[model samples]
Target: MKHWTEDLDDDGDEPLVRPYTITGGRTTAGRDDLTLITLITAQSSSGTDTSAERHALQPEHRTVLRMCGRRPVAVAEIAAELDLPVSVTKILISDLIDAGRVSARPPLAFAQNGALPDMTLLEAVRDGLRQL
Candidate 1:
Protein backbone atom coordinates (compact mmCIF):
# COMPACT_ATOMS: atom_id res chain seq x y z
CA MET A 1 0.00 0.00 0.00
CA LYS A 2 1.17 3.58 -0.61
CA HIS A 3 2.17 5.63 2.40
CA TRP A 4 -0.28 8.22 3.75
CA THR A 5 2.00 11.11 2.69
CA GLU A 6 2.27 9.79 -0.89
CA ASP A 7 -1.27 10.93 -1.53
CA LEU A 8 -0.46 14.45 -0.41
CA ASP A 9 2.19 15.05 -3.07
CA ASP A 10 3.04 13.38 -6.35
CA ASP A 11 6.75 13.42 -5.42
CA GLY A 12 6.02 11.83 -1.99
CA ASP A 13 6.88 14.97 -0.10
CA GLU A 14 5.51 15.19 3.40
CA PRO A 15 2.96 17.86 4.28
CA LEU A 16 3.68 20.56 6.82
CA VAL A 17 1.80 20.19 10.05
CA ARG A 18 -0.21 23.08 11.44
CA PRO A 19 1.91 25.74 13.17
CA TYR A 20 -0.10 25.59 16.41
CA THR A 21 0.43 21.84 16.67
CA ILE A 22 4.12 22.25 16.03
CA THR A 23 4.38 24.68 18.97
CA GLY A 24 2.14 22.56 21.21
CA GLY A 25 -0.59 25.23 21.12
CA ARG A 26 1.48 27.68 23.07
CA THR A 27 1.56 31.29 21.91
CA THR A 28 4.70 32.62 23.52
CA ALA A 29 8.27 31.43 23.77
CA GLY A 30 9.68 30.44 27.14
CA ARG A 31 12.27 33.20 26.98
CA ASP A 32 11.85 36.77 25.87
CA ASP A 33 15.42 37.23 24.66
CA LEU A 34 14.90 35.87 21.19
CA THR A 35 14.77 38.37 18.30
CA LEU A 36 14.60 38.09 14.53
CA ILE A 37 18.36 38.36 14.18
CA THR A 38 19.34 36.33 17.23
CA LEU A 39 21.78 33.57 16.37
CA ILE A 40 21.03 29.96 17.31
CA THR A 41 23.33 26.93 17.28
CA ALA A 42 22.99 23.29 18.18
CA GLN A 43 24.74 22.15 21.33
CA SER A 44 25.50 18.70 19.99
CA SER A 45 29.01 18.71 18.63
CA SER A 46 30.51 15.85 16.55
CA GLY A 47 31.48 13.72 19.59
CA THR A 48 28.60 14.65 21.85
CA ASP A 49 26.51 11.78 23.24
CA THR A 50 23.03 13.31 23.04
CA SER A 51 21.25 10.61 21.09
CA ALA A 52 18.99 9.65 23.96
CA GLU A 53 17.85 13.21 24.47
CA ARG A 54 17.64 13.74 20.74
CA HIS A 55 15.26 10.84 20.39
CA ALA A 56 12.84 12.48 22.83
CA LEU A 57 12.50 15.68 20.79
CA GLN A 58 9.55 16.41 18.50
CA PRO A 59 10.08 16.16 14.74
CA GLU A 60 9.91 19.94 14.30
CA HIS A 61 12.51 20.43 17.01
CA ARG A 62 14.76 17.94 15.28
CA THR A 63 14.40 19.87 12.06
CA VAL A 64 15.47 23.06 13.81
CA LEU A 65 18.47 21.33 15.32
CA ARG A 66 19.54 19.97 11.95
CA MET A 67 19.23 23.38 10.31
CA CYS A 68 21.44 25.00 12.92
CA GLY A 69 23.74 22.01 13.33
CA ARG A 70 26.54 23.27 11.12
CA ARG A 71 26.76 26.91 12.12
CA PRO A 72 25.04 29.74 13.96
CA VAL A 73 21.87 30.74 12.13
CA ALA A 74 19.64 33.74 12.60
CA VAL A 75 16.18 33.21 14.02
CA ALA A 76 14.59 34.89 11.02
CA GLU A 77 16.37 32.50 8.70
CA ILE A 78 15.21 29.54 10.76
CA ALA A 79 11.63 30.76 10.60
CA ALA A 80 11.89 31.07 6.82
CA GLU A 81 13.45 27.62 6.48
CA LEU A 82 10.78 25.96 8.62
CA ASP A 83 8.05 27.81 6.72
CA LEU A 84 6.51 28.68 10.06
CA PRO A 85 5.61 32.08 11.48
CA VAL A 86 8.36 33.84 13.39
CA SER A 87 6.35 33.57 16.60
CA VAL A 88 5.94 29.82 16.22
CA THR A 89 9.58 29.34 15.32
CA LYS A 90 10.65 31.27 18.41
CA ILE A 91 8.53 29.04 20.61
CA LEU A 92 10.02 25.89 19.08
CA ILE A 93 13.54 27.24 19.47
CA SER A 94 12.79 28.21 23.05
CA ASP A 95 11.72 24.65 23.75
CA LEU A 96 15.02 23.40 22.36
CA ILE A 97 16.92 25.82 24.57
CA ASP A 98 15.04 24.69 27.66
CA ALA A 99 15.89 21.07 26.89
CA GLY A 100 19.58 21.96 26.41
CA ARG A 101 19.43 20.90 22.78
CA VAL A 102 20.47 24.26 21.41
CA SER A 103 21.87 27.61 22.48
CA ALA A 104 21.20 31.17 21.34
CA ARG A 105 22.87 34.57 21.42
CA PRO A 106 22.47 37.97 19.89
CA PRO A 107 24.40 38.81 16.74
CA LEU A 108 27.76 40.57 17.05
CA ALA A 109 26.27 43.91 16.05
CA PHE A 110 23.69 43.67 18.76
CA ALA A 111 26.07 42.30 21.39
CA GLN A 112 27.65 45.66 22.00
CA ASN A 113 26.07 48.30 24.22
CA GLY A 114 23.63 49.57 21.61
CA ALA A 115 26.53 50.46 19.35
CA LEU A 116 26.09 50.36 15.58
CA PRO A 117 27.57 47.58 13.49
CA ASP A 118 30.89 48.19 11.74
CA MET A 119 30.57 49.34 8.13
CA THR A 120 33.22 46.89 6.97
CA LEU A 121 31.39 44.01 8.63
CA LEU A 122 28.12 45.10 7.03
CA GLU A 123 29.82 45.30 3.65
CA ALA A 124 31.27 41.83 4.15
CA VAL A 125 27.81 40.49 5.02
CA ARG A 126 26.36 42.10 1.91
CA ASP A 127 29.15 40.55 -0.16
CA GLY A 128 28.47 37.11 1.36
CA LEU A 129 24.77 37.42 0.60
CA ARG A 130 25.60 38.43 -2.95
CA GLN A 131 27.77 35.33 -3.30
CA LEU A 132 24.95 33.18 -1.98
Candidate 2:
Protein backbone atom coordinates (compact mmCIF):
# COMPACT_ATOMS: atom_id res chain seq x y z
CA MET A 1 0.00 0.00 0.00
CA LYS A 2 1.12 3.54 -0.67
CA HIS A 3 2.29 5.46 2.37
CA TRP A 4 -0.03 8.33 3.46
CA THR A 5 2.79 10.92 3.53
CA GLU A 6 3.49 10.37 -0.16
CA ASP A 7 0.20 12.02 -1.05
CA LEU A 8 1.10 15.11 1.00
CA ASP A 9 4.35 15.71 -0.85
CA ASP A 10 4.46 17.13 -4.35
CA ASP A 11 7.78 15.34 -4.83
CA GLY A 12 8.70 11.91 -3.45
CA ASP A 13 11.13 13.22 -0.81
CA GLU A 14 11.30 14.14 2.86
CA PRO A 15 9.62 17.33 4.10
CA LEU A 16 11.71 20.48 3.77
CA VAL A 17 10.65 22.05 7.08
CA ARG A 18 11.85 20.49 10.32
CA PRO A 19 9.46 19.84 13.22
CA TYR A 20 11.24 22.42 15.42
CA THR A 21 10.75 25.13 12.79
CA ILE A 22 7.08 24.23 12.56
CA THR A 23 6.82 24.71 16.34
CA GLY A 24 9.12 27.73 16.36
CA GLY A 25 11.85 25.69 18.09
CA ARG A 26 9.60 25.16 21.11
CA THR A 27 9.76 21.73 22.67
CA THR A 28 7.11 22.06 25.36
CA ALA A 29 3.39 22.74 25.25
CA GLY A 30 1.90 25.65 27.20
CA ARG A 31 -0.64 23.44 28.95
CA ASP A 32 0.62 20.62 31.13
CA ASP A 33 -2.71 18.75 31.09
CA LEU A 34 -2.56 17.89 27.41
CA THR A 35 -2.23 14.15 27.04
CA LEU A 36 -2.16 11.89 23.99
CA ILE A 37 -5.86 11.10 24.46
CA THR A 38 -6.97 14.68 25.06
CA LEU A 39 -9.87 15.63 22.79
CA ILE A 40 -9.57 18.78 20.70
CA THR A 41 -12.39 20.68 19.01
CA ALA A 42 -12.50 23.96 17.13
CA GLN A 43 -14.12 26.95 18.82
CA SER A 44 -17.13 28.45 17.09
CA SER A 45 -16.43 31.76 15.37
CA SER A 46 -19.86 33.05 16.32
CA GLY A 47 -20.24 36.74 15.34
CA THR A 48 -16.62 37.19 14.33
CA ASP A 49 -15.48 37.09 10.69
CA THR A 50 -13.26 34.01 10.71
CA SER A 51 -11.99 34.60 7.21
CA ALA A 52 -9.64 37.27 8.51
CA GLU A 53 -8.45 35.01 11.29
CA ARG A 54 -7.82 32.17 8.87
CA HIS A 55 -5.68 34.40 6.70
CA ALA A 56 -3.39 35.25 9.60
CA LEU A 57 -2.63 31.64 10.56
CA GLN A 58 0.28 29.63 9.20
CA PRO A 59 -0.52 26.82 6.78
CA GLU A 60 0.11 24.11 9.38
CA HIS A 61 -1.94 25.95 12.00
CA ARG A 62 -4.78 26.33 9.52
CA THR A 63 -4.61 22.63 8.73
CA VAL A 64 -4.82 21.77 12.45
CA LEU A 65 -7.80 24.08 12.87
CA ARG A 66 -9.54 22.49 9.90
CA MET A 67 -9.06 19.01 11.36
CA CYS A 68 -10.46 20.09 14.73
CA GLY A 69 -13.28 22.05 13.07
CA ARG A 70 -15.21 18.93 12.10
CA ARG A 71 -15.42 17.11 15.42
CA PRO A 72 -13.47 16.23 18.54
CA VAL A 73 -10.16 14.62 17.57
CA ALA A 74 -7.56 13.11 19.87
CA VAL A 75 -4.15 14.77 20.20
CA ALA A 76 -2.38 11.59 19.05
CA GLU A 77 -4.62 11.37 16.00
CA ILE A 78 -3.75 14.94 15.00
CA ALA A 79 -0.02 14.19 15.25
CA ALA A 80 -0.40 11.06 13.14
CA GLU A 81 -2.59 12.76 10.54
CA LEU A 82 -0.19 15.68 10.08
CA ASP A 83 2.95 13.45 10.11
CA LEU A 84 4.43 15.83 12.66
CA PRO A 85 6.08 15.07 15.97
CA VAL A 86 3.67 14.87 18.89
CA SER A 87 5.51 17.73 20.60
CA VAL A 88 5.11 19.92 17.52
CA THR A 89 1.42 19.14 17.21
CA LYS A 90 0.87 19.93 20.89
CA ILE A 91 2.60 23.29 20.58
CA LEU A 92 0.48 24.20 17.57
CA ILE A 93 -2.67 23.11 19.36
CA SER A 94 -1.67 25.04 22.49
CA ASP A 95 -1.31 28.19 20.40
CA LEU A 96 -4.78 27.66 18.98
CA ILE A 97 -6.20 27.10 22.43
CA ASP A 98 -4.58 30.33 23.66
CA ALA A 99 -6.03 32.16 20.64
CA GLY A 100 -9.53 30.78 21.35
CA ARG A 101 -9.48 28.77 18.13
CA VAL A 102 -9.89 25.39 19.80
CA SER A 103 -10.70 23.77 23.12
CA ALA A 104 -9.26 20.69 24.79
CA ARG A 105 -10.82 18.24 27.21
CA PRO A 106 -10.32 14.76 28.55
CA PRO A 107 -12.06 11.85 26.86
CA LEU A 108 -15.54 11.27 28.25
CA ALA A 109 -14.94 7.53 28.58
CA PHE A 110 -12.32 8.23 31.22
CA ALA A 111 -13.56 8.36 34.81
CA GLN A 112 -12.07 10.21 37.77
CA ASN A 113 -9.11 8.79 39.73
CA GLY A 114 -8.52 6.21 36.99
CA ALA A 115 -11.63 4.37 38.10
CA LEU A 116 -13.67 2.23 35.74
CA PRO A 117 -16.94 3.58 34.38
CA ASP A 118 -20.29 2.22 35.64
CA MET A 119 -21.31 -1.12 34.14
CA THR A 120 -24.73 0.29 33.26
CA LEU A 121 -23.23 2.97 31.06
CA LEU A 122 -21.04 0.45 29.20
CA GLU A 123 -24.06 -1.80 28.69
CA ALA A 124 -26.05 1.09 27.36
CA VAL A 125 -23.26 1.99 24.95
CA ARG A 126 -23.02 -1.63 23.81
CA ASP A 127 -26.75 -1.72 23.22
CA GLY A 128 -26.56 1.54 21.24
CA LEU A 129 -23.73 0.13 19.13
CA ARG A 130 -25.73 -3.04 18.50
CA GLN A 131 -28.63 -0.96 17.23
CA LEU A 132 -26.33 0.91 14.84
Candidate 3:
Protein backbone atom coordinates (compact mmCIF):
# COMPACT_ATOMS: atom_id res chain seq x y z
CA MET A 1 0.00 0.00 0.00
CA LYS A 2 1.43 3.37 -0.99
CA HIS A 3 0.52 7.00 -1.62
CA TRP A 4 2.16 9.53 -3.87
CA THR A 5 1.56 13.13 -5.01
CA GLU A 6 2.66 15.00 -8.08
CA ASP A 7 2.27 18.60 -9.28
CA LEU A 8 1.55 18.65 -12.99
CA ASP A 9 1.71 21.79 -15.09
CA ASP A 10 -0.36 22.58 -18.09
CA ASP A 11 0.38 24.62 -21.21
CA GLY A 12 -0.31 27.82 -19.29
CA ASP A 13 1.17 29.22 -16.10
CA GLU A 14 -1.46 27.99 -13.67
CA PRO A 15 -0.85 24.48 -12.34
CA LEU A 16 -3.36 21.78 -13.08
CA VAL A 17 -3.37 18.84 -10.76
CA ARG A 18 -1.37 16.34 -8.71
CA PRO A 19 -2.66 12.81 -8.60
CA TYR A 20 -2.51 11.05 -5.24
CA THR A 21 -3.77 8.23 -3.12
CA ILE A 22 -4.48 9.27 0.43
CA THR A 23 -3.93 6.74 3.16
CA GLY A 24 -6.98 5.42 5.03
CA GLY A 25 -9.21 7.13 2.56
CA ARG A 26 -10.21 4.55 0.01
CA THR A 27 -9.23 1.50 -2.09
CA THR A 28 -9.00 -0.64 1.10
CA ALA A 29 -5.98 -1.63 3.28
CA GLY A 30 -5.33 2.09 3.35
CA ARG A 31 -3.35 1.50 0.19
CA ASP A 32 -4.01 3.92 -2.59
CA ASP A 33 -4.03 2.55 -6.06
CA LEU A 34 -2.41 4.19 -9.07
CA THR A 35 -5.30 5.58 -10.98
CA LEU A 36 -5.75 8.05 -13.81
CA ILE A 37 -8.21 10.87 -13.47
CA THR A 38 -10.21 13.23 -15.63
CA LEU A 39 -12.08 16.25 -14.35
CA ILE A 40 -15.03 18.17 -15.77
CA THR A 41 -16.38 21.38 -14.31
CA ALA A 42 -19.67 22.78 -15.49
CA GLN A 43 -18.59 26.36 -14.90
CA SER A 44 -18.65 28.88 -17.68
CA SER A 45 -16.28 31.80 -18.20
CA SER A 46 -16.86 35.04 -20.16
CA GLY A 47 -20.16 33.68 -21.43
CA THR A 48 -18.29 30.81 -22.97
CA ASP A 49 -18.47 27.24 -21.76
CA THR A 50 -14.93 26.05 -21.44
CA SER A 51 -14.08 22.40 -21.48
CA ALA A 52 -12.13 20.85 -18.69
CA GLU A 53 -8.39 20.79 -19.16
CA ARG A 54 -6.62 17.46 -19.35
CA HIS A 55 -3.26 16.83 -17.79
CA ALA A 56 -1.28 13.70 -17.16
CA LEU A 57 0.45 12.94 -13.90
CA GLN A 58 3.33 15.33 -13.48
CA PRO A 59 6.89 14.01 -13.48
CA GLU A 60 7.30 14.62 -9.74
CA HIS A 61 4.16 12.72 -8.87
CA ARG A 62 4.96 10.01 -11.35
CA THR A 63 8.30 9.55 -9.69
CA VAL A 64 6.72 9.58 -6.25
CA LEU A 65 4.16 6.98 -7.16
CA ARG A 66 6.75 4.84 -8.82
CA MET A 67 9.24 4.97 -5.99
CA CYS A 68 7.65 5.82 -2.64
CA GLY A 69 4.06 4.87 -3.31
CA ARG A 70 3.31 5.89 0.31
CA ARG A 71 6.44 7.52 1.60
CA PRO A 72 7.01 11.20 2.35
CA VAL A 73 9.26 13.25 0.10
CA ALA A 74 10.74 16.69 0.58
CA VAL A 75 9.43 19.57 -1.46
CA ALA A 76 12.96 20.47 -2.46
CA GLU A 77 13.48 17.18 -4.24
CA ILE A 78 10.16 17.47 -5.94
CA ALA A 79 10.93 20.95 -7.24
CA ALA A 80 14.39 19.88 -8.29
CA GLU A 81 13.10 17.01 -10.31
CA LEU A 82 10.49 19.20 -11.93
CA ASP A 83 13.07 21.94 -12.63
CA LEU A 84 10.68 24.59 -11.38
CA PRO A 85 11.39 27.52 -9.10
CA VAL A 86 10.82 26.87 -5.41
CA SER A 87 8.41 29.76 -5.04
CA VAL A 88 6.15 28.42 -7.76
CA THR A 89 6.51 24.93 -6.42
CA LYS A 90 5.72 26.22 -2.97
CA ILE A 91 2.47 27.77 -4.14
CA LEU A 92 1.47 24.61 -5.97
CA ILE A 93 2.43 22.49 -2.98
CA SER A 94 0.49 24.81 -0.74
CA ASP A 95 -2.67 24.24 -2.70
CA LEU A 96 -2.06 20.52 -2.62
CA ILE A 97 -1.54 20.62 1.12
CA ASP A 98 -4.66 22.71 1.63
CA ALA A 99 -6.71 20.30 -0.46
CA GLY A 100 -5.54 17.37 1.68
CA ARG A 101 -4.17 15.83 -1.49
CA VAL A 102 -0.56 15.91 -0.31
CA SER A 103 1.42 16.10 2.96
CA ALA A 104 4.16 18.68 3.30
CA ARG A 105 6.03 20.60 5.95
CA PRO A 106 5.23 24.27 6.47
CA PRO A 107 7.29 27.47 6.10
CA LEU A 108 8.41 26.20 2.68
CA ALA A 109 11.96 25.31 3.66
CA PHE A 110 12.58 24.24 0.09
CA ALA A 111 12.57 27.90 -0.85
CA GLN A 112 15.46 28.77 1.45
CA ASN A 113 18.36 27.28 -0.50
CA GLY A 114 16.95 28.02 -3.91
CA ALA A 115 18.71 30.39 -6.29
CA LEU A 116 17.01 32.29 -9.07
CA PRO A 117 19.16 33.44 -11.93
CA ASP A 118 19.42 37.17 -12.56
CA MET A 119 19.01 38.98 -15.88
CA THR A 120 22.09 37.21 -17.14
CA LEU A 121 20.30 33.91 -17.51
CA LEU A 122 17.34 35.57 -19.07
CA GLU A 123 19.52 37.40 -21.55
CA ALA A 124 21.38 34.23 -22.41
CA VAL A 125 18.12 32.42 -22.98
CA ARG A 126 16.85 35.31 -25.02
CA ASP A 127 20.07 35.49 -26.98
CA GLY A 128 19.93 31.80 -27.73
CA LEU A 129 16.34 32.16 -28.89
CA ARG A 130 17.34 34.99 -31.19
CA GLN A 131 19.97 32.76 -32.76
CA LEU A 132 17.27 30.22 -33.59
Question: How does model 3 score by TM-score?
Answer: 0.31
TM-score of 2: 0.72
Output the number of the lDDT-best candidate. 2
Candidate 2 segments whose C-alpha is farther than 4 A from its true place: 1-13, 50-52, 111-132
Per-residue lDDT, model 3, residue 99, is 39
RMSD of 2: 8.0
- Tens-digit per-residue lDDT, 1-132, candidate 1: 887887664544554577778877899997889999999999965576568866778877888989999999999999998878899999999998987778999997677777887899889999999999
What is the Å distance of residue 65 in model 1 from its true position? 1.0
User: What TM-score goes with each of the models?
Assistant: 0.69, 0.72, 0.31
Candidate 2 weakest lDDT stretch, 10 residues: 108-117
Per-residue accuracy of model 2 over 9-122 as CA lDDT, tens digit each: 476557679888888888999789889999999988776756887787878888888898889999999999888889888999999999988999988767345667789998
Better structure of 1 and 2 per lDDT: 2
What lDDT is reached at residue 47 by model 2?
A: 63
**C-alpha lDDT values of all predictions:** 0.86, 0.87, 0.41
Candidate 3 pairs with clashing backbones: 2-69, 3-69, 3-70, 6-61
CA deviation > 4 Å runs, candidate 3: 1-68, 106-132
